[model samples]
Target: MNAKVRLGEFLLTRRSQLRPEDLGIPDYGERRRVPGLRREELASLAGVSVSYYTRLEQGQSLNASPQVLDAIARALRLEEAERLHLHNLARSSAADPGRRRSPAPERVTEATRQLLEALAHVPAILTGRRSDVLAWNRLGHALFAGHLDPGAPERPAQRPNMARLVFLDAHTRDLYADWPAKARAVVGHLRLVAGRHPDDTALHALVGELSAKSADFASMWADHRVMACTVATYRMRHPLVGPLTVTQQTLSQDPSLGQNIVVATTEADSPARTTLALLDQVTPQHGPARPTVRAGSG
Candidate 1:
């Protein structure tokens, strides 16, 4: 959780990935002893002394400036998200003692709910930081968790996670036609979440449970893979309906709950769209009303 250690691990991981030629470093046979750029090479690239870089990598250095972090990030070729994570790790290191940062509260704001209502035609749901289903449009329930209790409002305690459903729930397993692809995404998403919320107790608990209960999940989790998934397309086989080519987009609500709003939409005039519309029409009439009083707005 400490910045220096996180930075070191990140640098180590990234360094192991690039070869000498990849960074224009001459590599004569017997000139290299390790797989990645050495500490000296990395320090040279970042315009830092070998001793300083070594100390940082060993978690002995603290309070790394943003400028130094940027240099290191560039040296390691970190992505934007990774760079941000690096900054977060560094900045959080200097947190004042006795200061407790409560977990970021998650909720569905009135405006967000209105937006969902407006996009009622699309299958959309708002999820918390832990991937807890917070709220869903009528079609969203049908598209994703149609079998769950529609009457039960999406909340932190009662909400079913998309990752849990994809990997842990048998009903969800059967719901996805291309289960393997969906499974990879689930793990990748979890990886991304873990990287961001390394201190999230609930997230760690979820990961531990999934790793213990599901062998497939355990296998993927060991790979140490991380990815930021904002959009994806998938082929899903709905039991009530049939195959669907759906595109998933994740929206973040700022100054609210930071909840991720994921919406799945089919191609224009596609059978899936028609099926979704039909589902929306039939679901509310047949099932109980979806509970609205779930999260505390405050």
Candidate 2:
């Protein structure tokens, strides 16, 4: 989809999620034709004329000033990440069409590989901008996807996408104790990425595939929520290690490359930490361990 269309959809969705009462506007208890604040009401709150705001929302106007966008973001009560996403969408919409090009294939640098080796004791996975698994340490592979081939990340065609696994793979779905929360976080993060890289064909394709394959994903995508999942704690049910809670932290070695190292760590002196140690021992130095039990089987 074009940036203008995406921007319009985002605006429409966010507007529908807000009520006049949310901004202290009097509703007067009259019957309403649609949910949330009307277009004129939102324009009034953003200090813009109704026709101008309507034009922006309809994708008829692409050259929106940053000040105007910021005003609309304020009126919408967007979070910090969401505000950034709004700006990104507006900027991309105004950019020249010829500037859009296919992204280059991502690679794991030697430095990144050395860093992963150093983090062998800890579970760490390196992912590209679209969350494609680029590399992982031995323990990381064992902790996250021991059921799959250990060399899958080395093959672009077979590389596992975090978003796809979360929604479509039964093993991944079973791994998370609170599946819905994880699903929402994945969708939100993808939405944020989409706004930032509107021209990324692979990312758009992934979104399309997920939306078609999973009704849950389709619903979540329509919600238009955006989030940056940097650090979050999740309770997981490992087939071999049983139940454990770990915090996943995303570290960027190079922001310009859009590659991130997601490290999973458990609290010291906790049972989860002990569980991880056991898994680490079983994980081979070269690759993931051979699982005695299949994930999602139990």
Top candidate when judged by lDDT against the true structure: 2
Whole-model lDDT values for every prediction: 0.75, 0.90
lDDT of 1 at 156: 55
Instruction: Give the per-residue lDDT digits (tens) of candidate 1, residues 1-298.
Output: 4445655676677777667787898867666667888889989999999998888778777788899989988898777766776676666555554564557667667897788778867888877776788777777888888889864554356778888888888888987778887888778667666555556777888988899999999988665445566888887777777777888888776523447889998788988778766766776744325444558754
Residue 33, model 2: lDDT of 93
Question: Tens digits of per-residue lDDT for model 2 on 1-298?
Answer: 7888899999999999998887898878897898888999999999999999999988899789989999999999999999999999999988998877787889878788889989978999999999899888898888888888888888778889889989999999999999999999999999988888888988899999999999999999999999889999999999998999999998987787688999999999999999999998877777632224677888
Q: Model 2: residues >4 Å from true position, as ranges?
A: 288-298
TM-score of each: 0.81, 0.94
Relative to the unseen true structure, what is the C-alpha lDDT of residue 5 in candidate 1, on a scale of 0 to 100?
61
Best by TM-score: 2
Q: Which pairs clash inside model 2?
A: none
lDDT of 2 at 194: 89
